[model samples]
Structures are given as C-alpha cells and as structure tokens.
Target: MTLDVDEIERLYAYPATERPWVRTNFVSTLDGAATGTDGRSGTLGGDTDTRVFALLRSLSDVIVVGAGTARDEAYADYEVDTDLRGRLGLSPIPAMALISRRLDIPQHLLVADNLVVTTADADPARLATLRESVEVIAVGDGEIDWPDVLTIFADRGWTRVLCEGGPSLHGELVAHDLVDELCLTIAPILAAGGAPRISHGAHTVDQQMRLAHAIEADGGLLTRWVRDRDR
Candidate 1:
C-alpha cells in the first residue's frame, strides 16, 4: 500500500474535532526496540517513515517533545515548510513545545517560538530566566498534569498536537489515557540492543485502540491507531 506524498498527507490528516487531539509519532524496530543499536530513533526510520514523520510535523500546529528527546536529538526551533503549511491549511510555523520538569532547555531553542512546559516548583532562577523571553507553562508541582496541559492547548486553538516522545513522556501520556492517536512505524531490521520500548510509565492503564490504517512502504510498516472513545 505505497502512497505518494499527497496521499500520505491526506491519509494522516487530523480529525476535524473541536476537542484537543494528541497524536504521537514514533518509529520502532521489528523486534520492538524504540531506537536502533545506535541509541537513536532516526537511524531506524526509512524513506516512507521519514516522509510520514515530516508530514505529521507539518500538518500539526505544535511539535511536543520531552527535554531529553529534544536535547538528545539536538532539537532546534521548528521551521515548518510554508509551502506544505499552505497546502495543508496549517499555521505558518508549528510551535515547538518542550516538556521538562527542570526547564533544562537548550539555548538555541529558547526563542519566543519555543515553549518550555515545566513544573510549577521549578527553580525560580530558571523560571525567571525563561520568563524574560519564552512562554513558560507550569503544569504540576512535582509531576506533570498532562490533561490540564492539553486543556490549555485546546483553549489556545492548538488542538492538533504532535508529540515526538522520549518514551517516559509517551508512557505518562499513555498512563493518563491522553493519547488520541498513535502512529507507529515498524522498521524492517531487528534491533536487539538494550534500547527501551516505545513507552515506560510507572502506572499502567490498559486501553483499546482501533487501527485506522496500515500501509507498507519504504521497507517499513506505517500504521495509525485511533484511540477508542468507548470502553
């Protein structure tokens, strides 16, 4: 089920619902390693997976990531393609949102376009420094209140949220039952290294999801699963 660029975009379009939609995008090996032996998910993504990933970012209004993933991936300010944005009727640029408890964001990503979602009890000095320029969002005291955070985004018209995770954050989202869709790309190779799974939250919540689409392309399986609203 190989699809061209346009068909891929159409296939992954955000649901036209008023409520906030949290769509997570991740790539894993055939044997279920989130990252390859190189300790990076980028290494496992094939051409089709890469195309779908970029399209997901471009189509969404915001790019959400944890601080570790941002730092590890060396995430910079998100520069979305204007041509793609216009075609998809998306905003000019997808905002970058970093979720961190310590506010340990990189200097390059401290611009106004980037947001730091940190805990309310974060260091005053760090908060003060970020307050001078960036949009600082405080969720909880020690743990993040992801539902509240999503509600805030919904109010801000950032209903189309794209989360590129670092496992822990994805785990938390799953634990809280906040994930609306999961786009998993299964790479062809088998990576048996000590890489973590796609998610790792302490508390577990078993939820059912419906597979919306599955496509085979670029030596990988690109699949989308929509969260089942009914239990």
Candidate 2:
C-alpha cells in the first residue's frame, strides 16, 4: 500500500491508547544520503514524506534522538502547527530528549522541557550546565544505565515515547528490549558508504521483527513491525 502523507497523518492521529509507544527509525543510503548527494534527509524525502515525519513528531509526547543524530541532523526546535496539535490529540509541543554519556548539548537546540540522560560519573560542571538548561537525570552507575533511563522517562509520564534513531541508539534500545514498535523508512537509493546501516545490533534472524505493514512513500518504503512477544 502507498502510505501517503494523509494516511501517515491519520496513522498518528489514531488514539494513543491504540498505539501507546511508537518508535520511528530511518536510515538513508551511504555516500551523503538522506539529502541527495548533498547530505540532508529533507532533500531525499518528498513533500509527503516530510509531512508524515512532521506529523509523527507532533503526535509523539517525547522525541528521543541520540547525541550524534542531534549533531549530524543539526537538530532544531520542534514546532507543531496549532491546528495539527488538536487534530492529533497532542500537546502544543513535544519534549526533546537526548541520550548521551556526556552533557555536550547545543544551546540553540535546547527547549523548555529538554531531557538529558547521562551517567552518574559524568563531569560535574557539564552536569550542572545540563541541569540549568533542562531536566537532567542520572541513570546508571557507569556512563549510562539503560534500565534507569527507561525508569526516568516512565516517571515523567512518558507512556508513549517515540525514539528517532541514528543506529547506535537503536541498537541499544533493541538490545535491552525497550522498543515496543518500530517504524522504519527505507529509501530506494543505495550509497556505498558514509553512514551505518539501519541497525547495528547483533540479533539473529529469529530475533528480528515481523512486519505489520509495508507502505510505499515517494520512491521509498515505510515498514512497520512489532517485536515477537515470545522472544
């Protein structure tokens, strides 16, 4: 099926109770992918794709992205259309979350309700800065604790967390069995090498997900899947 912008928007607009936690993951071809050969995801995806992506962001209560993704994507403020928020049954804006060992976040990307999950052993000064900018939560004893991180979000009323990944984060989430749903956007073009693949985790075929749906968008494909419960 072709998942146009309207359909994608409707998918997100469905009641949160129907789809509590949705994680959207995407990876473009290598060789400066996501953009044309230039290097921007917006360029590669058409208008419909962009609209779908934006709607997904709007519907999510919290948008989780790795530090590398934030830096690479040059992440900016998340703005949702006033009318769209009502349509999607969402808050005015979704909180931005960054998972990193250190507290090296850009000032401009900082929002009112930013969340930083780091290790207890991180630099004290950096922790102070992060706390001043947004809500800082110390998770694990080491660099970062996955379980603690999840607990922190759970405490913050994030019942339906949306993770937007850059591979490494996706690997960690999948490894810890923290992901409930996976929404992947697969672009048609293939580049030889500049970025990593969709997932970096070490999972056998049996451990992989079963497709829930496969929909074409632009020239690419968007695949949604749910993890095997028995696994």
> Per-prediction TM-score, please?
0.95, 0.83
Cα miss at 45, model 2 (Å)? 2.7
Instruction: Provide the clash count, candidate 1.
Output: 0
For TM-score, the strongest prediction is: 1
lDDT of 1 by residue, 126-216 (tens): 9999989899989787987787888888888898999999899999999888899999998898877688999997887888989998888
Instruction: Give residue 109's error in model 2 in angstroms.
Output: 2.0
- lDDT by residue (tens digit), candidate 2, 152-230: 6667666567788867787777777767677766677766546466556666333567797777777776667776563
Q: Which stretches of candidate 2 lie above 4 Å from their native place?
A: 1-6, 12-22, 30-36, 87-89, 201-206
In model 2, which range of ten residues has the least summed lDDT? 13-22
RMSD of each: 1.6, 3.4
Candidate 2 has a TM-score of: 0.83
Error of 1 at 145 (Å): 1.7
Give Cα distance to truth, residue 195, candidate 1, Å. 0.3
| Best model per lDDT | 1
**In model 2, what are the clashing residue pairs, if there are any?**
34-40, 35-40
Give Cα-based local distance difference scores for all models.
Answer: 0.87, 0.68
